[model samples]
Target chain A: MVVRGLAAPPTPWSKSLAEPTIDETAYVHSFANLIGDVRVGPNVLISPGTSIRADEGSPFYIGKDTHIQEGVVIHGLDRGRVIGDDNREYSVWIGKQVSITHMVLVHGPAYIGDRTFIGFRSTVFNARVGEGCIVMMHALIQDVEIPPGKYVPSGAVITTQQQADRLPDVKEVDRQFANHVVGANEAMRPESR
Target chain B: MFFPPLQPVSTVQSCVSGDVSIDPSASIASGVLLQADPECRIVISAGVCIGMGSILHAHGGDIVLEAGAILGAGVLAIGQVTIGANACVGSITTLFNADVQPSEAIASGSVLGDRSRQIVLDGRPGV
Candidate 1:
């Protein structure tokens, strides 16, 4: 059985509609930290020294079989940005089998689709990444919509609408990262030993 | 340097080789790793808040974190780096060879990788 090392926030912070939930099959490393209002799916691997804080504006959701690598940071919005007549808060969604690599930063309200690979040291801020996308290392994804199967090169900055329109589809060879990262990360799990 | 009162919530697990000092009223969160080389030193000044999983390594050079600097979660720093007073470093930022100016914000910054550097596009770096 996996130990639940995740902690609930203090009183005033807890008063928000934030709740923390994790599936029993997930693997969260002992050194990793998860703050309030985050939901983790099954077979997820939260690697060592990673922090996912949803204390601010959240109801963050991690899709099944996703892998959050070492030294990554994920935060909720400073305030809820989406306002409907009903005043409901929408969660930031990370889809199934996604690979959020080492040193990555993901800030909501962001939606990353299934089988996507967010490379090392990349930043995704207030963006929507479609299914099967590859965001390479050192890339900045801000306020954009990366279409399905798109491949963003390393060190590329996608901020302008023109730049978002100019992004290319993933090369066939690079699709391997999206295909294998989930199983590759699962091998690093302690129970796999 | 003199030590300050450590909060009960802070977790300090560091491996030191040389001189390392931290001021009082500093909050070093859980899972932080501080390493000081035999020759160099690491110093964290007052009112600094180091988020969880930050690695401060002073192996090749000295590290000085001035007063009121904030290091967000999963930040990595090494070498002769000085985070000036009241500066804020966002999460996953690496100051492997950096000198952040005081009150500067290094927001979601990262060093470029070998693949990005190795591309010989038109005989110059980057396309």
Candidate 2:
């Protein structure tokens, strides 16, 4: 499912929540918003100006005693854009007691483990996060894997944009048919070819 | 009458800072920012020292800084990465989508090791 933001940062104050789990002691912001098919654990705290949307591909799950800070965005995506069941598209999974701070964005087909803390303004797209991992603020993640109990310092950039490593040989496919129409009815007769 | 689940959108008060997720044992100086996404999870372990102007951002992914991790001022990190025990990240250091091994000291302007590098961190002991 492709959800387009009405504005650069859409603040849907009047939008009603479908079904969400929130603690009484937790504090969430006024400008922040959330969509349906999302699950939040207990003792979990949410801050203002944040938005979350769980794609039909996968369910968004947050663990107990976790905190979600301000200006953060979380969403699920499709693994295979054109061909796949709704459940097969995005396999994003978050472990128990994970911590995510402000201005952070996490895309689908990703997995995050338990007892980990993420810093501010970080970006993660299609990656795997192990348990007890610490991602510092302003770090960019592109198709990466964070080891268990490892730390990423602030402002680090990780991307597969430039690959110096040699890739396996795989030929690109070329289109074969420009326009070819063979009607079965025309050739069905004994004399037709 | 039946009660309903707390509406994330309907609530008037929203913002992570309003909730004190800071551990009592952890020492976070003034001007340090800790923010959490409403749809994700975040946690700061004990004995972590965040300098002034440092920001911790998390989302659906987990970000854990183990005990005794010292972050310099104005450091920025993103995504799901762990700062192991006793690791020191320099001031204004930027880490993108990677991890630093435990007890590693990474100097400024250095690249963080990836899967190809075999877990050897710069300025780390025995490196």
Candidate 3:
């Protein structure tokens, strides 16, 4: 059982015809904030203190039967979070049943394909997420296009140098942090979406 | 207004409004300053302890700690850097631009820079 947001914003108010339909069975946990016109599917769980919103003019979309666990946040800023509007068949369109976990932050414009499991506390900023990919917990995914059926291991920092450089770092400061610390992983098959 | 999960153990004063990820199980001593980008996200994992008078800033990027990761007082993981799972980082050391390998013991030191340079573990004689 999953809890969803307060209510889906009624369509006909925005210029974009496509609107999100949230399932009654999804779980949107405490302190989880949602904005913009995004679709949230069924059985999705959103944890505490997670904020999912779009900038004043854009929309964010989520698929059906997905589970976004506690503290998971997805948002779009200054631009709409885009999903499921592809031109080709088998060209990867967003579908039903995607799962995003606790404390994961997603920024747009971004596309997360169908039936994917984005692990806990993972950060996806400006990237294309493929289908059936298991993005492990605490992974930093930024500005990279993930192929379909790929498995991003836990704590894998998956961003380019350009994206990494965008974040500022103060010099000569005492810096010690866990997570994003490196480790080996066993080869595993991509989970089917 | 979300109060801390436990009793008011510490007080967060006025600062820029950014995301602060606090672990419920971990103890944060008083006078901790955490700054984050209102636009970006910040995540603090489980069973991690952040000591007193510490500040963690996440701007342009996110700050994350995995399960069971321990940080001595005043430790800072800054910018494009990641400390692996179950790794212990000593206090007062600043990590500017590097990723620490998991379970690789780091005793009170700073690891910085990318694939470009080697990290000279602080307090250890002879590079």
Choose the strongest candidate by lDDT.
1
Cα lDDT tens digits, model 3, B1-127, are 0111111112233122356666676555543445554455556677766654344545446667666666665454544456677777775444544566776566653334422112221222111
Q: Judging by DockQ against the true structure, name the best candidate.
A: 1
Off by more than 4 A, model 2: A1-18, A21-30, A55-57, A80-91, A160-193, B1-127
Expressed as tens digits, the lDDT of each residue in A1-193 for candidate 2 is 1111222334354255356555554444445566665666665555545667763334566666566655466766645221122233334566666667545676666667776666555677777767676665456666766666665544555555231011111111100010000010121122222
Cα lDDT, all candidates:
0.68, 0.51, 0.48
* RMSD after CA superposition, every candidate: 10.5, 19.9, 14.7
Of the two candidates 1 and 3, the one with more favorable TM-score, higher being better, is 1
Better of 2 and 3 by lDDT: 2
Query: Which number leads on TM-score?
Result: 1
DockQ of each: 0.06, 0.02, 0.04
> What docking class should model 1 receive?
incorrect
Docking tier of model 3: it is incorrect
Indicate the residue-level lDDT of B22 in model 3.
60
Question: Cα miss at A13, model 1 (Å)?
Answer: 2.7
